[model samples]
Target: MYVSLVCRQWYAVTRAVLVLTRPVVWLETTPSSQLLPQLENTRTLIIKRPQSMKHTTYVTWRDGEIQCWTETLNRLRELSIERKIKINKIEIKRHIRVDTWLIPLLTYTSLSLTNLELKDMVHREIPFGQMMKLCPHLVVVHLHYRDTGYIDSICRHANKPEYEPAELPDRLRLQSLKLDNVAIGRTILMRILRLSPDMEELHLKRVAKPRSFANEWLNTDDRAEFSQHILEQISSICPNLKSAHFSYYICDLRSLASEFHLAIDRNLFPEVSYWSFKWCDLSADTFQALKTTPNILTTLEIIDDASAEDHCQQHLHEFLCGAPNLLHLKVPKTLFSITWFDLEGIVSTVGHRHGSTDSTTTVSHRKIWACRNLQTLHIGFGCEGEIQESAENTRLIFGYLSKVCPRLQDLTIRYSLLSLELNRGFCLLTRLHELRRLVILTQCNNDKAWNVDWISKLITPSLGARMKHWAAEYSTMNLGIARARHPFTSTVKNPLLHHLLEPSIQSTVNGGDRRGDEYGHAANAERRKEGQLSQLVPDYFINGVDMRNLGQLEDIVELLQDRISKDWQCWPSMGFFELICLESDPNGIEPFKDTIRICRPDVEVK
Candidate 1:
């Protein structure tokens, strides 16, 4: 607005640029008709409940407050219906029930809305029939967190809620519906599904009590019967659904109803190429069943709540052997291919723990991974055995992966656990020409082990290879920001630096063997002559970054007590540090990205 004031040319350009961005309109602030030019694009609107009503419960909301919002919405109606500012999307993110404002909202706004999202509802009842009829162009809908039982418990003497017409008037152009954590009735669920017969995606994270959707009185048989009906008809109903994600919740109900996700029911997902499962309690039977089927999955993710590989019936082996079309597979757990060994002393009663093995199992059946075309792999790698044997096994694993999944671009693993030795383990990954991102999650003291030279070696300039992103996050977090005293001399420019970081008084930034490793002989010579960080290093990194190596147990920082170059600062809690440089490009988020690109597009900086 300030820049546009210079001339009409700037205003015109500003308006044109503003038109590209989806502008937000606050429903409470009704502007005068003179400001009509401001709201030329009425695509998305945000309405908030009156601030005065924040402390009050929904049940006790005065009619005055309700009228305030309704009147404000009427102003928006005048703009849309009369002024012809066509509405494209309306998302009600308010925490109150949908029924309170939705009916009047529909009456007062244009019915041509293409997208609608009402996810944060406190009550279950919503007029689905009315909403679809009002907005026929609605393509995507996200309905969630509607728990009427919660309302009854919170508010005393609450009247029994009436669920108005749950059926749809007609099939709209709805293509996607994400229903999660909702306690909706069966009629409502079926109605919503049938409303979008040609739906493309269904993300049912957790739809509790499908039986409660119909039955006023619920039982075990109600759940079992509902689950059976869902498993049989879900596929036939949404015949055009290309992607679907189904997961379990509320143990008792899940055991009875959500059996569609239990591995054996391949018919439930006829042609779903992209599948994901979170805390689905998947076991060896899940992958074993995939082997018997005609595998068409391109992406598969199964995450456990415990993350303890308890079910070991060919769990890792099954996926590697089966899914030939697998491109992206992420099961965040440490998996070992070799069998007959207790890992981490986790003795589980679920699967058979082999106490003995034949001599023919010298290789332990650790073969090449079957997912040869895998591009994105995020899983824990572990080798359980003798030291030399473990190193050999790791070598085989990486060597095989390098050959098999040459197209692999994204890889995430633990730092110390991977044991990525430059020669034995890490060197095997040199053949992976397409690898772009290597994210290693480190525990406490592993950050200083890898330096710029190691990174350069990993990038392998000989092959014209370059890493797009290299991130290593320290997992150990500090609860309190304890400002400890510096172990080194406090006279190092600032006392706060010494106190906060606790660096050794005997050493400076480039003192002792530090100079030899950081930049090799070049930095070592410079530091030897200067013998001070003022000339060799800057004050920004004195106590500004992860100062554990400078001598501290954990990463420490004092944000308010700041003094240094303004370009950089560190907050250990947020996983921000000065080390571990990121490779920059034209598409990078830095302010000078565009200028740097124009100046030197070919030059890469980290």
Candidate 2:
């Protein structure tokens, strides 16, 4: 029965080898009795080797192999002796905590192995240097976890030499090396630098956690010595290194302070520029740290969580003070009010969490007068100021901006009361030679009042007037037709004549009041009460013709176009009227673009 089971296992092993072509394909092994037929039937089990196949090998735990007949095993060993078949790659997995099974394949054959990965194999009391001596052409090596076991094995093999033994790979010319969770003290870092001289990529993850001695060394001198060790590695070993990443503050910040200075001393970092970090604390001293660093740092994003506001502000102030080649600057919202000393090389300034100032009563209006090359400014006004205070402040702030940042193109003032009148402080905005687009926004539900007529008159008069005229003409015609049964009533006043004649709407529209007769319905009165300005015309005009019903938007457009064509010299900028019906609230503007488009096709809704 045991013999039959061994035969079945050997057959399974032979079938597996026949299907798998690669020699080093990792697999779980079965019993030893299945070994003979598996090796003999290798030709039948394996596929025809690819013509381009340079090398192929197999690797698996000894236990994963099937049991073979004793007669087959003896025959295979004799065949190897007779035919000299060299194994290219071999891996003996130590599943049952066994030492590496050293085969005679490396000693007898001239075939050299390039890729070697010894995974859970017991490193029998042998130095790592000795293992490399067996395989000279090794390129990639991975030593992950179980470091203590391997270290114990290496110390056992430490030979008594005239000089101290090297702990790292010196003979092997490696390209990639990965050490994960491996306990490496300060000695290991310096050793790696000397050994893998041609190494390009290095990942020391969680390796710094327990091994970094700088954390435990309480004496400043001990910490300084530890820091010096790292600095020497960077200068001697990683001189040509293009990329580097290290964390957990393993080195003393005070000892290597000069290294930070030397980085920008020469024009060294031309190709190396991008820097990103978290929880970086730079006191007022940060300016001295990065002042002469050249224009290599073009884009920088810093997320600082400093307890002191001045510390954060001081760092940014210094960085911007010197970085003349910096094109874009993105800072936190808290620093906007911090009065920038030198904002050179910076064309754009983005302030996060800076739009509103509602709770604070007295906001000292700060102006950015230094940025001469500054073009775009986005100010987010907080919900602090009441309508009048907000409007007055807006005028003052925009006036300052126009004078200081003359080359401004696009300006967006968000969440504040918008004033069109160039009140004392606002007149300076007109001096901005390059100002083209200006946007003012307020909350969706806030009662933020803005005189649309005033803004349209100032920004785009031709389009503005056309919209005003259309509304006025429509209202007049509608009022004329919808007069009351008693046409001369005081309540139903003449809405149109009140505005054109100018003095007062009550005096102008109350013409029929003396006769004690009402003219218009309750709906018209409701609209008139909402600050509806009036206009005057002669009494002989169309009686009850209802011009509002007849005057469609298209008709107004055609009328304006005709007038402009006939009198182009008189009305140069005035042509077809373009109406942009903004959401009475700021939040509604974008969503209500369709509404404005449907009403006036030529109008720019957004």
Candidate 3:
């Protein structure tokens, strides 16, 4: 029998003890009653006092100041090498204020603190410059505070009369900084940039919003000016930065575009490679700026909640056309039109002239002009119109790509267009013989409407003998039309026998056929059933049946067999079949299985 660790608190305590023991050190005005015995052999100790000590909660910083806390903390410090002192955060609940306290526990332990976390320090009046001068050995700093009033506090602290160097152990050693929802002014942001030039990663989330207007700077245009200011600050501060994520309550694409444009113009980043834009308004101009960004952007993602179809299409086209180096692109399911984008100058001189890199590689009377670096294409959509249009455009785009993007490997087509006429259009892929895998997603109803015979005849042979993998997916609704109700069913019936019978049937009928059959004879008093205008002749259908002249299934099968003999190579994998969600009944399952298995034993029935 095995027992689960169901009690979370107990499990946490057990796990913490098993990891190792470190000294409990607290810096405060008074010593604690219960000292941590584990600290007796500790190698280092730190104590930071809290603002108040009125609360007696167990986890509160004030609880560490009791006499037992002092004893246990001193004991632990004597036993281990690393000491950590955490200050409790103050919370006001129901108009009641809770006080948190920290007490000093000094020891001669010599362990160097490799990691340090400071919380709830009253920095309202302390200059940021002074605060920096205090934490010298800090490798990572996380500053969390209310956004409404914090920036002013930091600025006020920075302007204090006495100048103090930031106590950060080594300014160059700090690798990461996270400022969470803290109000930050432009001056403070600049100071941080100046202070930590060597920092590898910086995250400023929910930072202070920029002023609405600035009088002195040029480019006072509402959208462009504010965006330029933000971009300039980023480029100036984090030039070597690799990745930066900025998400706000709301952000306009123009602002982001201005920033990216500034980064390109200033050559701000040589190493920055990944960028993410989320919930930002993207326009044509914004996309234009992305194309000019100087750094090599390997991955670009845009996530938007906008529902306007026209805006979505415009932005998508601009991004595809301008961002020549982008390799992976992801847009909303509503943005499928973006995928249908054709490199403007693939086949014509106009396309090549506009193509990036001026690579003159030409083949098959076509040239690839756009997205030469694009290798992976991921798209999500609910309909097929976008895909059809994209396929048509891609036929032209791939002509020039042979030499330019020789490494192009994968193509994923996902949509629900299952109409016979449209599925037939898939034969267009014969042009990309270089493709290794072909994924056909039949999740949509349209994909299920495929006539297995049509796909087998059209797709298999056109794809050169080099093509190896073949996949056919069945949709939930097979969308199969019955033979009798088929539009051409009447035409396939016996022509001469039907003409001979029509005259005889009309002789007894008084009125035209009530069933609306195109070639049916008129109804008569003998055929009518009381109030019914017309009725089928039960005796006439049994004795007057037209089977003598009607074509038989075997005859049709024989003809199909002849066509198959000549076209077998067209569907080399015809034997393999898969049926999905087919009513889950033996009746629904057996017929299709028996039919397909007769022609191809490898047929799969599901």
Candidate 4:
């Protein structure tokens, strides 16, 4: 108002600034007299009702505010009406009646509106197709039904013979559609798809059965057949579809295998590069089908079912040989059992014979390295003590990963238990010049606590020189016998050895060593207090050692100062040393920060 009073030019600039800064506005109640005119030029409007607001109050506010926004709606490009409160029986029924103001507002702003989202709508009937028809320029539509009951009602109305077909323009501009927790039947889903012929992405999460067949159990065969039919329809209608996610139910594992075979046979989703499927048993036939379009799939996730058989391992090997372009592979841990021979085979297949002098081998004799281009590998193993039996195999697998996957950057290993012996193989990871991140997660006993020595072996000075991030976490399932000393405390504390090892421990220091005061009197009390503190503090590693121990702080500071001053050129400016000393060791970072400033004045620490 002050700017408008100043001059016409000033008023014009102020209006432009307001339009750019306040393009979207969220209102929980009717706009105040002061704010109404200020929101006249808003390009996007988001109406949100607080859960605490009374139903009657919401209705009054919504009606009055929407009526006042008639002129503003004409210029609106995006509109989202979301009800966060739970609706009572009365309110649900009341919401079923179409808000008289909504249709008219949509009709007037049809050409301008491009994005719309309706979430947790309590209405008994919402003409979704009709709304899309009215807004011909809509590019994205997200509909989250309140419950299966609402979806059933919509399906019933849509099925009516006298129901008028949605008025659609010559070409639909919609590119993305997301349906959450909807229970529409096949025909209704087909009709929805028919509206958006140029859709690029579609997401259907937790989709239930139609209202009429909510309790009906379509057998595995029937469900798979129906799914194949739906996918076929989608492929035929949306040629430009790039990504799709949908949950599946398979009574028989073979049904899932059959579905994949049929999809590949028909070349469904030929251009799709990303796919996520729920837990299922993949058969050899499915792997064979995957070979049909080897290079097309870039990201694939197949969650494992506990009851599923592990017969797909061989099939997976064959699939990898055929699809050498896969960049991301995630599967159950049991499917992968790396051995020395596997490493040799991979090296020979990829023609990466570094030290070998065997030049007589022909190209036909070499196998195709299936995952030559793989960058991210996630292997999830079951918690049945299997990891213990194959501990050495796990080590060999890690040691050879860089050799097999020269381009590997990210690796995640999930298992039930991990042994310390695996550390030897972990040291080989330093060979991966391009590797940046390594994560190991295990749900097992912490009986064998990992210390700085173990961490140092894996993240050796050479590897640490190039590695950006690495973490190892263990979650204990049951309580084990307690040890006398804190799990990480070393009996012989040599400053030189401490400086070299940089052990990762998990206990805080108690002022001084009271171990000799009494056998089990005050010492027990102190140990219990330290144990409680350990439980409160999360596990963090400094140079692979637990960050709780302050015993090696002096040694660490001296070592860092010396390294930064002498070998500063060779040291990683953003390496693990900085990560652990300055970043992970929050309570002890101050000392290292001071040391860096005093010693390496030229190096900047962030």
Candidate 5:
């Protein structure tokens, strides 16, 4: 408005540029008719209003707002109408009906629209076939219905005899489709897939079982059969599909087995390189079939299924042997207890070498090789036992990985117990010079041996010097103790660690309100009290330097006093030193505090 107001000449030039660029236009309230002309060239449009205004009365207002912008949507390439309210206390009712608001928008942008995202839509009978027909040029479509019940209702409506099917275009331009909590029938889902024959990625989450089956057994059987059929059809129909994800409440193991079998038999999914199955069970036969399949998967994630661990472990080698190019592997803890012998076998197989049965070879001469291309490894142990029993095994795994997987950059381990021995095992990871990010989730025992000092020990000079990011979470249920801490030492040459540790002034003032109050008092009196307190506190220095500076001296004194008052009599650990340094700043301490809070909310940074 200011530029246009400069002069008539300026107005004409600026308007023309605005028309050509057509930047994103965000509307929070009802768009007026006058504003429609200005948005004629807009490429992206977003309509998001506050929850307070998403009431029944505002439905008409939003409907008119969308209708007013219909004509201008002809040139629109992307549109997102996210009216879903995220407040936990408020129950969201239908704000805008899809048929009334969404269908018209689709019709208007039918010629040019490429991306469409409809989030938090109320459960209703959506003419999906007709909607796809309206947007023939759509390349990406994301729909998140409220729940599976709504999807069940839609499935029922679509299957009705009175429902008329729309004619789909000869070739769809769609490349990606994501549906959350959708429960359409097999036929309806197939119809939708048929419309996107060239899709490259498909993600279906929380998909409900069809309701047409009479009994639980029949429903499970039918679902499995349908799932297998869909995979086969997708392989044939969408040969370009490269990635797929599926998640559900009850997994059909038989269906998964059949799907893998069909993929092997028909040599399907040649182009697919990524697959994720959440809360799904896999049997030994499925793994056998997977091994037979020729697909060179780059990433495979199978999580949240404890019952399938034994089967996965028994056949994982076979399956992985087939996928020599696998780069990312995520498996349950139960399936990840790989022995030294198993490690050697995998190395030999991946490197295409045959090793001797004799065990006389030295560790160095025994060929450090396996999954050379693997870059990311995530293992979840599911909180079954203490880490003490498996400490040596876990350590050996790390030692092996450091030598074999030279390209490994990211590693994540969850739900394990940690002690001094385990920390030492982690230190062995220094051999992985390429490693950039490391995350460990463990329950720390209350014993003095497991203090925060162990964290510094894990970051050996070699690892600490190269590691870009490292995070750890520790808790003591026996003592009702929890603490989250991160290392932020600037003296270290590691720029990543320095950036992570850099203090924020605002967090310091906020986290140190009590100390800030004391500092606000008369300087002489505060110094006298600090001198007295310093005598009672132990002599401590950070990074081998005595704290003579005012900021460092004040922070340490306050921290000791707080610990003593709380009756936490344990000696100050490295965590205390880091906290004191983080709280030394009055303006820049939030990022450090937030890293600990978000990673381990139970641990008190104070």
Candidate 6:
């Protein structure tokens, strides 16, 4: 008998004891008859279609599997009622069509569900309106509909006729509605929205105007009218909406604004903040729309889209300087913000006034960010010249963030791996006392002079008191800073370098033979030969970081490595440490991990 349970809140289990208090339960397959009664405490039920079977076999038994799944859930629902325990959330994940198991499950357990998420559902006639009708108490609904890519519907025999809707709700108790990939038809979407008067969030991603009935598609003329109506009347329909995200539509926001001919006073989002620009490309119209956002707006996210130019994306520095009340600003890999943040790399102290380093000499007064309340940020810093300057600039970046955003708890930095001299000025981060999670993602750099092995000088300090392993599991710090160096042309004398050496070279490393050195010169020549290397796995310069040179990786690895030394304890809350490197160079990642693993043998290097 196989049993699995998943929960958001984690608990510790020893060899002698097991706890069944998990709130989130996943019914990945139809459970045995004995399983239902034990799952009465479940608060969130994630129903997912088992994906082990091939298309042919799945097509054959799809209906039967769904039926059994629904039957099991029905029994679970009965058990919940008997125990007076309600399942609050139901997330139907992967390629399962909602129509197959949705109505059947809800028919028995409608009152139990408060939150519903139908993700990656098949594009077919879905009884979404009926679902709202059944689960009138549902507060949050997330729906994503896409044509099933894995299964060719044309080749398979038609299952029964498409599902017909039986009922519709009058007034829904909804607070949030998220639609992805035009999940529902125009007729049904309107019906659901009209009912959800008190909706607080409407997140629309690549939504389309769907046809009402039959195997029909979109009507362009009808779509035009509906699009305009949706743009204009959405605020009126959901008057209580506080947040909205409209993203990745084929149609332009500028065109929509022009076609509607909206007045200056008729703000599209008067009461809400539109966050779609975070993931989607920002245009002139979208950039201009930010001007109308009220000072009360706290969260804003905009990602770098290569398709859009610099002017269209606007400046991140400008936004930060302006939005003083902003609690969160997330801009991922955006070149729009990489101007100058004046943090001086003080190689040595010149003078100290009142035992404090002079900020006037160190920090630039030219530009300053006013977003003092910022709690989370996803930003990148870049420079035009050599990447080493970026490494020097890292201290300044961390110093800037620590000063301006004192409340920052989560930060994701994007930059070149060569630029992340992880050791140098890492002490600046210890000032950010609230910083719970720090993620560093390396932006790709094709520069040939990349040397990650020798960035920081050996000023090593462990950033923790001895932290417990279970505590590390609860929180994590991730740094992904591995890029493949151009296969080295230079040869080294270290015996540890044998891994990257030829067998003939390896044999002669111990003896005073010239063969190893001669072979090393030849291997270096072949490594650089044009069209000579097939990069399924690149032969990286593995032993460039020899044991003698291990000090180069230094305290940067120690602070980031989680296991603390005896003396160090300032950054006491340090937890899980994750280091992700290059996929092409399997050898590139190992050298760094091998060094760290020697220190803490139990830590998994993956």
Q: Model-by-model lDDT, in order?
A: 0.46, 0.36, 0.39, 0.46, 0.47, 0.48
TM-score of 4: 0.47
Runs of candidate 1 with Cα error greater than 4 angstroms are 1-112, 116-127, 146-167, 210-226, 252-268, 278-285, 303-306, 312-317, 330-361, 376-606
Q: How many backbone clashes does candidate 4 have?
A: 11
Error of 1 at 458 (Å): 13
lDDT for position 137 in model 2: 62
lDDT of 1 by residue, 1-606 (tens): 334348887777666444424546443344444334544555665555456544333444456545656665566667656655555677765565455567666665546577777745665455556667776778887766543433111111111234324335556677887765543444445656776777888776555444434333333232212355575566777877766666543534444323543534565666677665654335555555555555477877654332334354256555675566789877655444323222111222123223222223322232335676798887654433322223333443455455556677776654233434332344445445566665544221222233223222212333222111111111122212123332222223354464454322222332212322232335446666786543333221221122221111121112111112131211111211111212222122332223323333332422
lDDT of 3: 0.39
C-alpha RMSD values across all candidates: 17.6, 24.2, 22.5, 18.4, 19.3, 18.5
lDDT for each residue of candidate 4 in 150-263, tens digit (9 for 90 to 100) = 342234344443552543344667788776555444555666677678898876644553222442432222221236777788888888887666653323323445666678
- What are the runs in model 4 whose C-alpha is more than 4 Å off? 1-127, 130-156, 162-171, 178-181, 202-231, 244-247, 250-256, 275-281, 303-307, 330-369, 383-397, 409-413, 418-441, 444-606
lDDT of 5 by residue, 1-606 (tens): 334447888766666445423334435454555445544445565555455654323434445445554543442323223221111111123334666666766665566667777656664545666766787667887666664343433344444435525434555677888776665555555666776767898877656655433223223333412356667776777788888766653454233554555665566778777776653445566556545556767877775555334445545544653454779987644334333233222222222112231224422222222366788887654322332434434444555565456577777665343322323344445445455556554443312332233233223444333232121111122112101212112122345554554431111111111221222235434555777432111111111112211111122223323333343322222122122221223233344344444434334443
Residue 392, candidate 2: alpha-carbon lDDT: 30
Tens digits of per-residue lDDT for model 6, 1-606: 423435533222321133344544444364555456445556667765565642222223355665666667677667646654466787876555445556766765676788988765554445555777788789998877653332111101122224213345567888888766552344445555787778889876555423322223333333312354566666577777777665433434323333222421256556765354533344444434454444266777653343233443344455555566778777765643233443222222221111122224421123356676788887764443343344334555665566567678777776553233334344446546566666655533222222222212221332232223322432232111111111121233335564664332221111121222343555645653754532211111111111111111222343334333333333334332234442344345455545544443433434
Window of ten residues with lowest summed lDDT in model 4: 82-91
**Number of colliding residue pairs in model 1:** 6
Clashes of each: 6, 37, 70, 11, 11, 1
**Residue ranges of candidate 5 with Cα displaced over 4 Å:** 1-112, 117-127, 144-156, 161-164, 167-171, 203-233, 244-249, 252-255, 278-281, 330-369, 386-401, 409-412, 416-606
By lDDT, the better pick of 5 and 6 is 6
For candidate 1, what is the TM-score? Answer: 0.51
Report the C-alpha lDDT of model 3 over 1-606, residue by residue, as the tens digit.
434567987766654343223544544443444335323323333443444442222133344345544465455444434443331111121111112112111121213333433344332332344334433444555554433333323343332223223422235345566554444445445556666777666655444444422112211121112245565666666767775555432353224554554555565656566565553534455456566666677665555443335455555655654455777654433334312322222122231112221113211121122465665554433322233333223332222233233344454444333221222334333223344433443332222332333333332543322121121111111112112221122233456444543422312132222332344434445346464543543211211221110111222222233334454333333333343321223243345345434444443433
